[model samples]
Target: MLDATLKTQLKAYLEKVVQPIEIVASLNDSAKSQELQALLQDIVQLSDKITLREQGDAKRAPSFTIQRAGTDIGVTFAGIPMGHEFTSLVLALLQVGGHTIKLDDAVIEQIRNLDGDYEFETFVSLSCHNCPEVVQALNAMSVINPRIKVTTIDGGVFPKEVEDRQIMAVPMMFLNGEHFGQGRTSVEEILSRLDSNAGVRAAAELSKKDVFDVLVIGGGPAGAASSIYAARKGIRTGVLAERFGGQVLDTLAIENFISVKETEGPKFAAALEEHVKAYDVDIMNLQRAVKLIPGKIAEVHTASGAVLKAKTVILSTGARWREINVPGEKEYRNHGVAYCPHCDGPLFKGKRVAVVGGGNSGVEAAIDLAGVVQHVTLIEYGTELRADAVLQRKLRSLPNVQIIMSAQTTEINGDGQKVTSLSYTDRSSGAAHKIDLEGVFVQIGLVPNTEWLKGTIALSRFGEIEIDARGQTSVPGVFAAGDCTTVPFKQIVIAVGAGATAALSAFDHLIRSGDEEPQTTETKQAVAV
Candidate 1:
């Protein structure tokens, strides 16, 4: 080991010469060069990391605590954090650290009262700068809660550590020792996870199994609200959804929703999730309802190979985004390429952004981004913008917004750090043009969130589960509403209304079937003195 004197001597000597030339010659000196390289290698190791992975109180199972030093809840990134992943992490931290999003004051107050610690150690390669947003969001969330901490481990330097953790991608997070959800989870979703973990699964599982007063089939807006309302009615309610929030989670934004006007689809979905959890409703997310045998006790078959018995079913299966299937689009989503500008546009503030498709959503995204970002590039495969005339006129009025009609997205350009630009082919010119931008939002349209329910429920020609005005399906005891349903227009207000209607209608059905004996799984009762 070099003594302090030798280290000072080396520093002095190195300061006098240009680094590159000196490094080459000094490295020629076998012993010293080997020593220098070894020292650098060691310094990069986790043990020598300037910042450390957090260790919470350990007592808090459902929540984690953050370690704070000052105003800035010190976060250290060993590598460049520049892409969508980094942005998300930052946002998550901001929310966790008391950064309020575009939510109402009431919602903000409710979230502010939440306290927990989170530590995310995302494994990333030097080439994956596009993933910085995830870290950034996490850090932002940490700021909301002083207990949250997010760290990044350079995969290039620590492949063994990543392998030991079984990390298969550029990004992953672990809460305590157990693996949490994957990909990019919104701040609200992460909070929901913490909340869900707080509820004892066994205690929550103690719902009545024999006879449900109300049965909610879907897990979207309508189903979530329906179950909540019904359960709040002091009646037995059971909810089974492929996933909670149904197609609402699939939505990119809910600006059209009354009173909200602007919010991310996932964040908005999380707000609804908070409402769902505020009640004693039985939730079965990520389980599809395959078949429904409507009768006194409707037997619903699930994709997980489990049969569920409910009194009435509310189907809120949502829709899926229709993809262009172009190469690199899926791989680059949220990595510089995105589908929801509302969810990601803020990251590109004063930076360049892009939007694909000629529909209203695309046009609106472009317009929305134009105001916040430095440049807005719009791509459409058609000869002209297909949005309404007013939107077209406004788009034309914006100097930063470029309209590229008849140009189809052919390829996305990136070094895998983040998307640097996009390449498109112009049918009229038989040529292609590449423009540098930070993001790409696709607005081609979406598939009804009802594909998995083929034999389970009646579906319309558009793949929407058919529903009545009261959100009831063809099956007497089953109901559905929202984007996945046969609602002509998929809007936030409409979905909320449909969800409320389904809840009320399901409650009424349960009341009408009073002949059936009710059941309870509760064993605890007060002693009659």
Candidate 2:
């Protein structure tokens, strides 16, 4: 149930609807449609301009179409609008009701000139924080062009469809019947993917090789810092990143970074990119590296079959949150199990939630959720919490937060649809316990993103790239930094410093090896790294 403040806000938003918006519900099962109908009725009651129309004899159990001005607008939601997806539904209604779509002039023209009929089907888990952005963007595009049919599916509700498509992650996009991509994607990127066959053919025909003086494998703080340092030396530097922000994008608030009192992760990432672009570094975003070939000139191959060559390579590919393997963990993801607390915490507002792990991340997530959720049960497998003293103290101060020690999570018990409870074993007493909750947030630890460097580079036992004091790897010209390397502590400031040191080391190597043009008698200025 929504609070009074949220209800007031929703009412205010609905009152701004310009054109009459109609909700066409295809009802096959009355039991399944009750919640959806109630939600629609509540929304319609807020504004006289909105109404709902039920259509019988539809095959779909719970599907709805939003129409305005007698046009379908090609927007549909296959499941009940709840969780993080509620924002998507609300934004779609506003966009069709006359909200100005914020897009580039070229992008708007491209949407207006769309060539063929494209059905944009977005499969998302309700708990995914990044899912709503993609869904809302496509929905707005649908309003811009009638040919772009947009359909949103709840991955948790329609597990059969997700399985048929072999979708392992949320925010998975599909054009027509072909799988487009997974994760958060921009509107421009989706438009480029409309003609998938032609795009692939064009990419294959233009097999070009790009050579750089120093190539950074990631685009996070470490990679951005390295590229900036290398570019300052007047050398050709480039960075290839999957999303250009790394793990920082998922973070909600960051106060540890020096000089800045407080900032959000996405904002900090954008600032990092702007600073890096201030130099002459070439940034390649949305490129996933699949393989690394070590040699005199190291070669990096992307998922798109593109090859990049560099005299020296810097590996800063960051880490990701590790998954706690247990029964029903993957099956009920986004239904009642979530990974990002800051992103999905609001969805479980006024509801009980469980947090796994006892480290800094786990304790921090518990503290963060304690303010939003009604109660938080933190389960730790270790004897005591491994969080910092300050974090532990803060967590103890929370009245609604409870921490369980030496508890090994055995299984995630769910009702085949959403998580109802979680089962764990007390290692000391050899007893099992289960807690009833609406959501579970896993915050065990981080896993390095160095799997592609298995045979090409020397790695530590934990799959981290082995680096020395100067950030140089075992290979002659190869270097590493950030969480992907054997860094003692994974922090933003430390990664940035590591990146700078690696770039300076690389420049020193190039100078000593006489790779750059020899200094002339007329110019005596030394090259700065």
Candidate 3:
């Protein structure tokens, strides 16, 4: 199962093993089990310190555990850890073999101090871009605290468990057989959920932070760029974000990023975070900005009841997938409604589904889902598909795809627990119709994340932050960039350039305005002009 180049890389990585480790495989007489055995055998050949053992009887066949020779520090993978999870498997091997985990020292200590037994089971699809983070996080915790056991299950491999649990989403997590969460989650978020006092402690710590010279309110490509540029100017730079990488984490294939011919979203996001961390920027993740009060020293209030002050604030909160606001849509979000086709398509294998849109994303989703699903019904509000001609042609060529034009999605019909059909209105005929299906994939455009700044600063009619050519907002020292701003394009490359401009504009404002006193209403209006 291992290729020539992969074996060489695996050998090199395994050489870092400071302690003996064992790969205990739980297998049966099945094709998947045979494949797992071959993979484990290939791994065993790479290092003398590594050993593999097979056990016929186990809860999940074709599964394996990577554990220290004599210790319980380990993590389990119930399927072939390839694709996006390949890095996760390698990290588990090294960390179990006594290699250091690349996490904060305080976080490791907190994991070790956790009191109870926490068994985490995460269901993921190999195509999912968001699964690795959650798997790696839980695996790291298991390594630190033996009481915390993590089992990553491939939804494609074990369809029975997925159906039994009613899982229609990738990276669906369960704690002790109960639903914990679904979608992208971080180690800090998991910790905050488990520990009651974690939020209070974090809030208190943030409240005591010194005023920043340049504080970035988002952590996407734009925020990363702004932080790097500001920090390079020898200013006190800080970043506050609900999560790093922003919408990029939800993205799958990204081939448009210049210099890099092709790369996955998660990988590119990691590089962005790594590049920012190389500087002296203080990154505060998992902090949501609730209110922004502009002044000479701007005050940004977070949902955790913490107030962070800064000389200049750069908003790069970015945008999110627009939801189809129809009845039963919110009720069955993860049950049958999904936004990402790459992540959740496998879960709806062989089931009929509907794609609600005719844009590029919608047509692309229909094409992708047609391969995995039994049938795909594409509904568009416009008379014609707005997708590229090539994409539209490919979608039309699909045998199991159906397209409906001049239709508006009326409602998503579900059976209380899961979606069963979708309702739409024929715009030209003035008639309504419902199609039977198991899932509804909404691929409408995106809405900017600037709701908090509505009353605080100038915003476009569409809610995007209003900014001048220099990336300067109407609030003088305050600036905005990326998808949150009035920037024409929402591409990552454009966001990076805008971030640089905003950072430089902020520096210029700082030097010109001076650090004397807070701006009065009269002076603020004058600066806006």
Candidate 4:
């Protein structure tokens, strides 16, 4: 067993790369196995093509398409597979390469008694930051049955291939190469897939996850609202999220947060978190649901090795920042350029900054940075800014926020250390200019948090989940709300409303079935209704 100090250090060391065991082994024999250690590094660098890149490819996928790599052999991770997560990745690779996690006799028995091997694959993206668990749970399922190969690919780095295969979300999976699934799933349901062999090919397209008594997929405003509704309704509710508060956590201010009218994003998110915590719902943090198997009882497999069974499932795993799709743009993200300007823009205070794209996000970021930086250059690839007229006027009004129209950012210029500047071409002028910048905010657009839903749920052409007015997907039991879902608006209030609708609908479903119990007076009084 590792000592406490060693364990802590090990945990910190894991933040850097995959293969923690190998790192430990190399450090142990660094002096004696110097050549071998060097060889390992080379192998990690050269053979780490978990996903393929066409000769002309530029950026990674919406994130890595942690699918297509195939059961372990071509294992590709959509996100940074580090931290405690490395162990899960290793185990998955070992199993795919032919190995298994030593399960207790009881667990192993469950595996043996399992009717068959239900293969699963989870695609993920590194920027997702919440997708690691989806990768782990699928691996655990694979270990139960080696024949049940669970392939994971990086989605950010392989857009075309995953798109060609029709990948719409991360933590996506395909069972038996035909019945595909997404979001998250429990081992029991995974086994059911093997036993039933239902959606092998039908999974290639998107569809909603299996419904349950309660399905709260997001931990954001909408998700919290739904969870509160279901729990108060006496519905056995469960929630899964990439993180709580969804995109709300990325916002710097909540000038419009209810009751208080104003609050910081994280602060409001924490408040919402506390409220969610006040309920009986099962909430998992830093945990992601990778696949959802539609069946009698929906199974949810968390990256943290916990399997939850719910009568209904809700999806609110919100949106992530859009990218520049440049070659090194990804490799150096957070290293210099960033997404949540609130979290990272301050790092470049007093430094020259450039905001790419002309969308509201980009323009708004430029305006926000004008006061903090010496120079703020807002570059728009289109002929005009797509941001709202107010935002365009505000961006142009900032003396420091320079607007460049008819421009396309070609590459993010950087040194081996950090970002140095950006290179873009003025399409109309046929001129290219390089601006020295300490940071580049690529606000091209927002990619719906629906990539993982590709194979499992139906998605709108714009990449949002397709939900009815009641927030129901094509699948009966599953429901979605938030920026990830295909509702008309992407605002926080809209998402909250969607969550409420989903919860009420799911509650009606449970009551109609009579499988769920009725609510007590106290439970009824708990909700705002």
Q: Give the winner by TM-score.
A: 3
Candidate 4 accuracy as lDDT: 0.62
Off by over 4 Å in 3: 516-529
lDDT of 1 by residue, 34-85 (tens): 4434433322231111222222233211112222323445344433233333
List model 3 lDDT by residue over 255-353, tens digit each.
998899999888899999999998899999999999998887899999998999999999999999998899988999999999999999989999999
Top-lDDT structure, candidate number: 3
lDDT (Cα, 0-100) at 330 in candidate 2:
90
Worst 10 residues of 4 by lDDT: 20-29
Question: Taking the tens digit of each residue's C-alpha lDDT, what string does model 2 give over 38-62?
Answer: 7777777787877888986543557
Steric overlap count per candidate: 71, 0, 0, 62
lDDT of 3 at 426: 95
Q: Mind giving the per-residue lDDT tens digits that candidate 4 earns over 1-529?
A: 2346645654443334332222112123223234323423433343343223322131322222222233333233433344334555545545443344454465455565666555555655543333454566566655454545555555433445554564433345666676365543444444444544323322321123333477677788888888987877755576666567777765655665456787666567768878877878766444566666765687766544445667777777777777778766876665566665543454455779888878877877888778767898888878888999998887777777788899878888777657788888889988989898877877776777666667787888888888888888877778888788877667777777888888888877777777666767776776546
> What TM-score quantifies how close candidate 1 is to the native fold?
0.58
Clashing pairs in 3: none
Clash pairs of candidate 2? none
Q: Write down the lDDT of every candidate, Cα atoms only.
A: 0.61, 0.83, 0.92, 0.62
Error of 2 at 50 (Å): 20
Instruction: List where candidate 4 sits over 4 angstroms from the true fold.
Output: 1-212, 429-431, 517-528
